[model samples]
Target chain A: MSKKIVIVGGGPAGTIVANLLTKKLKKEEASVTVIDKTGRHVYEPGLLYVTLSDQDPKGIVKDEKDILNKKVRLIVDEATKIDTKRKMVEMKSGNRFDYDYLIIATGARLCPEEVPGLKEAAYHFYTVDEALKLKDALEKFDKGKIVIGVGGVPYKCPPAPAEIACFLDYKLRKRKTRDKVEIHYLSPLPRIFPIESVDPIVNKIFEKEGIKYTTFFNVESVDPKRKEVHSLEGETIGYDLLILIPPHRGSKVIEDSGLGDRGGWVPTDRYTLKVKGYDDVYAIGDATDLPISKSGAAAHYEAKVVANNIASEIKGIESRDKYNGKVVCLCDAGNKAIYMIILQSPLVPDGSIVC
Target chain B: MSEEPKVDRLIDARNTFCPGPLMELIRAIKEAKVGEVIGVLSSDTGSKRDIPLWTSKAGHKLIGIYEKAGYAEIVVQKIK
Candidate 1:
């Protein structure tokens, strides 16, 4: 019988792993399977542009079937649970898949409901649907106070909120409503970006753009009717539209499988990408709460390391692939772009780098 | 005039971030002559689905796709 490899979550990490594995295995050696709930794969980073109505939403999303390797079985369903000991996964559709090795790539999801009144009042641009909704809202509103709030730290794409703020500034100006609409950026961190070194550059950009910046203002709750956001620091900001980057959490399946830490992210050897408790199971992307920012690029690099290690283990060889926690981010600084690089050691030690 | 030999090329983009693999595939295809086969190896969930769709719309033929240990290899025959 051929070796069966099952990958959960058809995001960047899972898909990348599946593709690489197919290249290594012959037709009779191994069979790869990928499972995802959605049929559409959206370019998540493009959401910032989508929210500003700068990019066509359709261009950012693609059909999942079109990307899968012909050899891999693409299963479209929700993964309800993982039975590591039994080496099987139970799906919401009541189908169970048995595997010799399992890779979890289910990325993070934004949970606005975690904060009171946020689900009802605020709009999010984390997903394709959310971005489209935000685009529509922004286009319809003539002139009003637009508040861009950073719900908490460790959100995916650290620079997204700031990028969106800058884009909104330009958008409002292009609409000739700059004088009427006020844009405010609220964050819990002391500076625009947590990394002290990068703050000087980011802070300068914020000032040059004329965006009102409030630091150390932790959002407590939101009142939709009053269009107000109350912070734990005893300050309130009122706005006609709220574009929020909500707190992110790990997959519920990972938490329920007992593989997650206190924050619900899978705990793994930062260098190995191996789940702490299970040898046959590995986690990648936002599913594993590594110290680095949870972005597609991080997932891609982590997947490379995990794939090599997993391949070595399968072949009865010593695994040598190790993650160095490298991260690269493309910050859209209004009209131009800034490419930032953050190494792993400094990030893990300081825990303030804007990855 | 003689017909150009169809070259079979496989481009692996698995585990590569956005715009990286896609951009590379476009460049590789452009360098190849018509009737040449270009295989893309991408595991970025988005690319697995996007490449074929884009290839078909761009007038290319998808030969086959297969998955190995951790990535997917998609073969495309450039027609235009």
Candidate 2:
């Protein structure tokens, strides 16, 4: 019988693996199936630009059919549960697919509603839909205090909130409303960039841009009716427009499958990308609780390692490939771009290199 | 007349980060001649898909893709 490979999630990780597998294995030898809840595949990192209306939202979105190779089967359905014992995945559409090997790439999801009144009062730019909504809200508000708050740590795209603040600063200036709009950035961490090396540069940019930075201010709740976001430090930030980066967690299926860690991320071998318990089950991208930041680039790197190992396992070859936990991120600092590389191999403090 | 030079260039973007390797690949493909193949070796996971998608959209052909030693090699044949 032909080998059946089922991949859950059609985000960056799942799509890349599916495409690679289709290129490597002949259709007759192995069948690749990709399951995703939505047909829309958004270039999530581009959300930073989209939220600020710097890039057209349409450019960031592409149909799933457009990206998937011909050899792979794309299934549009939410994976409800993964039955490792049965080697099958149950979907919301009442379809169960059996797999000889499973790659879980179900990416992260944001829960702004978890914070009281946040969904109603604040704008989110995490998803394409949210980006569009935020763009409309920002354009309508001519002049007022704009607060960009990070709800929690380990969120997707660590530098995104900073980028948003800078882009908004540029946008307001372009509209000649810079003097009218006051922009404030609130983060849970003490520095703008988690890595110390990159913090000073980011701090300099914030100062030049005149964006107020507030650290160690954990947001407690949001009162939509009053247009106020209450922080744990007894400070309530009032805003005419609130752009929020909410807390992110792994896919519901992974949590429901009881395979995720306490933070709801899949537990995987740091190097192999294989699930801790089952050798046949592997995870990549934002789904895994890797030490790296949850970003598209990170997911893509994880996918390469996962694909190589899976192919090696199927061919009965010794897999020597291991993830080095390296990440490269691009931060748009208004007029220029700042590229940061984090090398986590030596286990340095925060693994940061700013350029 | 002799045949045109089939451009064959390999971009070793291993250990590089987002937009850095991706932007480089884009620039390399643009500078290459038509009917040439640009092989991109990227350890950054996003480049594997990003390169292929960009090639396809730009009217190029994704000839092959494979992963080795934690790096993904994607070859794009410039049909345009």
Candidate 3:
């Protein structure tokens, strides 16, 4: 009997592994099935360019059919729950699929509702629509205080807030409104960039770019009527325009299925990418509670390791490939310079680099 | 063949972000004549590869790519 491997999610990690598995094993050897709600694969990082209206919104995504070749079977259904014990997956459309092995790559989702008055007052910079809205607000503003704050902790792309802050300086300057636009950046983290080496480089650029930033301000709530965001410590920052990086959580299906940790992220073996407490089950990408930057590049690397290991398991061979916690991010600090941040085995001693 | 392919539109997308450069190329292509070549200068790291990929995918021809000190100029001719 041919083995069945079901991958939950169609994000970068899921899509990559599905392609790899099909290419490695013949259809008669093992079959592959992918489950995802939306049949579109979005290049999420491109949304930032769309915000500036430099890119078309329609160009950011590709149809799932185009993403995965016809060789791969795609179930355009949302997985509602995964019963590891029974080795079965249930979908929202009331369909069930059995799998000999499972890979969960359902990435994180934003939950801006965690903070009161946020949805009404501020714009979350995660989606294409929100980014465009912020861009529109930027275009209309001639001058005023713009507060770009981090809602809480564990958000995607930790440096994105700083990038926006610096980019605002350039954007406003290009419009000859530099002197009028006062950009202030606030984040809950104790420092600008969590990596010690990276924080100073970012701070230097922030200082040179004239962006006023304050760290350790955990936003507690927002007051749209007053046009202010209040921190947990009762500190408040007034804004003419507000851009927020909202808190993120794992997918609802992962949380509902009791497969997630306290933060709704899946618990997996750091080196092997195997789901903790279960055999023949693995997790990758943003959904896994891995101590690494949740970025697309990182997910691509994780997919390679996961696919190789899974192929080994099917062939009854010992797998040698392991997921090294390495995350490399490239940032353009608004025409000044491009910097790269490299963090390797961050949970271990002395394993981070920033340039 | 003309050395420059009769450059018609010049897009100054330098210092802009990714997809920004690509978008500028697409916009210029849309406004230019079918055979006119559009040139875009971009500092985004992704543009060098992205522009070429997009040009091929859109059924257009990439005229040339010139790399400067900090940025690159990608030229494409709208084929269809």
Candidate 4:
């Protein structure tokens, strides 16, 4: 029997899973259709390099048609609602897709406005546009108190804030303005990183780069007009320039479909990558509230299991691979120090990063 | 037939994404001696244009580009 696999969102997880299926399964066995609104695949990890002036922003984006396999039918449309019970998806464009199996990998959507005045007060480097904007802003910035704020917990790319701090130091040094600038960073967690083995190493980096760090400082609000940010605990900090990683939520389609938690992140079985209570449906990448880092690398791992398991079921065989929540993060601390951390996570079973 | 330019180094960048292949080629070129032929295997669609552009910009010699199963082998030689 042939299968219709409809993958929503052509980000890392969807694109990789679609590629795996199209490459592994015969065209007669399955038809893969991937639907995404943007139809552009951004290598998000590379966005850091763009901010550092090491990589071109254009280099990080790949056309969806170029990355997805030729056999995979690509649709550039917004997935408005997913009718899980009906095994169908309703798109904003009014197209309907029926799926024997579905994979939701829409990833996170940044919500800077969640923090009062943050949308206007600070620059962000999460999206291609935001990153390019930050690059332009940095180029004009010479000497000032620079602040990198982690808006809240459960943001994408755990090491990005620290990396940005170090990269800024490196940049300032090159500009001969190191003495004129002060870099400060804050993490919602108690430490710089969740992994025990990686925390101390990251601290060494903070010390080496001379960047100040404050732990357990979850941002509560910002006063863009005053150039100040207040923590949840009421601690206030002033900055000349602020770069923030905003709080993010899962795809609205998942939330509208009532398949996600209050935070809008879908719940998936950590090991099998299957959406809870949805035997025919699976979720991967930042879209799933998996107990691991919400990163492209982790999505690559989860996609392997989802793709393989679907293939096995279609072939009437047993699946052998499962996701173990393993995440490998290469934290690029400027000055050629690339800190590496390998861990089994979301840091703890409760999915909280307990420093 | 003219003998194919001898490749002193071959980089299998297949399965590696954008910037991955380019970064690897850069490292190989840095380690390579002048006049050494370096061949980079990339599956990334962007490499065809990226590598050649980099080669020209970096003052390296681009020998030839060969298509193979599932990837392209971009051959270049290190110069001054």
Candidate 5:
């Protein structure tokens, strides 16, 4: 009998694991299946380029089935609940999948409505629609105070807000309107970035670009009428155009399935990538509470670890592969240079490159 | 001056992106026996710094990083 392996969420992490399993396991050894809410998969990193440039949206969108290996089965349905006791997955379409091992890679969700007036007032680029909307908004603006504010912590892509500020400044300069506009970056942290080593490098770039920054500014609410952003500290910054990075939470399926914490992030073992107290269950990517940067690079490295270990377990071989919290990212500075940040741990960069 | 270490096995991960060369080296290290030297050729510049960092952190011996044309040969010895 073949072992049933079911992966929830056909995002980068899940898709990578499902494909790797096909290469690792023989047909008689296991059967792999992936459950995704939508059959579409967006190239998320390309969203930055889409918002900043006139890059066509079609290049960033791909059918999820097309990305997955032919050996793995893809279910275009939402996973409503996971019964850990029964080792089953219940879908919203009244479908169920029984599994010997379950991998949860359901990533985070952007909750713009969490902050008052944010959904209606602010602009974001976390999704395909949002990126296109923000791109249109950027084209019409010529001269005004453009404030890039972060609504809360644990948002996706830590370097994105800084990246957006640089790109916007460069765009305005190319338009011959650089001096007419003021660009400010707001963060909830005490520094420009969460990583101490990377902050000085970014601060230098901000200083040279004349992009002002405000730290310790936790966005409490957005005042659309006044065109101001109110912080928890009672400080308010007015903006003619507000690009707010909305707060993020883990997928609602995690919360509804009672597998997540208050913030909806699953309690996962940092090394083994296993959901805490569940040996047969594993979680990866932004779904885990690893205190690491929620980036695709992290998810890619994590998927390798999870896949290797699961394959060994299924083959009755002992494998000690563990996720060492590795994350490698190349951030665009919009100045003909890209910054590469690598981490062997949280909040510390093992190395960086400016090229 | 130390003599250049002999390469026991080589993993050619050239033309790959970040984490690609590093992952190939890691997987090769797992399959290697103790006291065997594993060399990985990576064109990705990020791996030039990351491979050494990973080798030291993983408690392996870093033989040397030999720079080649358009790529680098990162050699490490499996200690455990």
Candidate 6:
């Protein structure tokens, strides 16, 4: 009998594995199935562009069925629990699928409500609705003190906060209101950017662009009525406009099934990408608690390793292919110029990024 | 099944992490003549499973997989 490979989540990580499996294994060798809550697949990186009205939102989304391989079964349903003992996934619609191998790529969820008054005051661009709303807000605003920063760490796309700050500066300049608006980039970390090497470059750009920034400004709460942001460090900053990247957590299924850590991130083997305490289950993308940026590049590289190894297992071959922690990320510095950072291994210093 | 296939080249990839072993095997396979048998010793548990798949994918013949003291010896013959 053919092995059953079930993937949860229809993001880049899930879809890449499913498509690659279809190519590696014949129809009779193994069946690939993907279960996603939403049938729609959004190009999340495009959300940045959507926020600035750089691209049409319609161009970045597609039906899951349209993108997935025809042989791979697509189930548009919410996975509620994963019965590891039985190797079955239970869905919200009372449906279940048994799998010989399981891959979790549920990605991260934005929790704006985690911070008091954050959901009411901040403007974020993580989702379609949020991006569109921010776009509208930016279009209407002429001048204000725009306080832009992250609400918490471990959010998807680590560079997004910095990127958005630069984009905001560029936008205001385009409106010829650069002198009127104050752009302050804030962060919870001791440095503006997580990567030490990249932080210096960002500082140079922000300085040249006349953008103010502060580090270690961990958010305590926001007072929408007072138009102020309170940091745990006892610092209060008032903003006429606020753009904060909301805190992120793993999928609810991971939390509900008790399959993840406090932050809902799965404890996965760094090299093997296998979830700890489970031999047959693996995690990729934002689902895993790997200390890497939860970017598309990270997910795509991790997916290749998972797909290659899983396909080998099904083909009666024990492949020793492991994830090398390769991530190729391109950052938009605005002004129609961008730079790429390719990290072969984040855990080790390879001197991979060049300014 | 007990008799070990004769290999023209041997690549000891012990203590190497995945893709490392598989990558060495591929490079060795390329350098060897078409009919030469190549064996790769890998301590990476994943490589034991990955090499065989890669050999087959590359249209090479997997002779056999032998278990060693702390590593796996995977033998593959270049077919084309």
lDDT of 4 by residue, A1-355 (tens): 6799999999999999999999878988999999989999999988888888779878999899999989999999999999988999999989999999999999998888778888888898998899989999998888889999777656787778878887788888888888888998976544665444467877887787788987656687988888998885447889999998987878788889999865688878767788989899999999986545678888888899888889988888975687755555666766755544444443212332222
Residue-wise C-alpha lDDT for candidate 4, range B48-70, written one tens digit per residue: 87678767756688898888787
Task: List, residue by residue over A148-228, the lDDT tens digit for candidate 3.
Answer: 877755567766777777767877777788998898988554456655446788888778878887755667799999999
For each candidate, what is the lDDT? 0.73, 0.75, 0.76, 0.79, 0.82, 0.81
Residue-level lDDT for A126 in candidate 4? 93
Error of 4 at A296 (Å): 0.6
- RMSD (Cα, Å) of candidate 6? 15.9
Positional deviation of residue A161's Cα in model 6 after best superposition, in angstroms: 1.0
Model 6 lDDT tens row, B1-80: 58998888776655532124565565456456889998988665666666676565557899999998877899999887
How high is each candidate's interface RMSD, in Å? 18.4, 16.7, 19.3, 18.8, 15.7, 19.4
- Identify the superior model by TM-score, candidate 1 or candidate 3: 3
A142-238 per-residue lDDT for model 1 (tens digits): 7778898766444787667877887777777778888888888986554565444566776876787778888656576899999999875568899
Query: Against the correct fold, how does model 2 do in TM-score?
Result: 0.77
TM for every model, in the order presented, reads: 0.76, 0.77, 0.79, 0.78, 0.79, 0.80
- Model 3 CAPRI rating: incorrect
lDDT of 2 at A260: 82
Clashing pairs in 5: none
Better of 1 and 5 by lDDT: 5
Model 6 TM-score, 2 decimals? 0.80
Q: Alpha carbon lDDT of residue A113, candidate 4?
A: 74
DockQ of each model vs. true complex: 0.01, 0.01, 0.01, 0.01, 0.02, 0.01
The better candidate by TM-score, 2 or 6, is 6
Mark the 10 consecutive residues where model 1 chain A has the least summed lDDT.
A343-352
Per candidate, native contacts kept equal: 0.00, 0.00, 0.00, 0.00, 0.00, 0.00
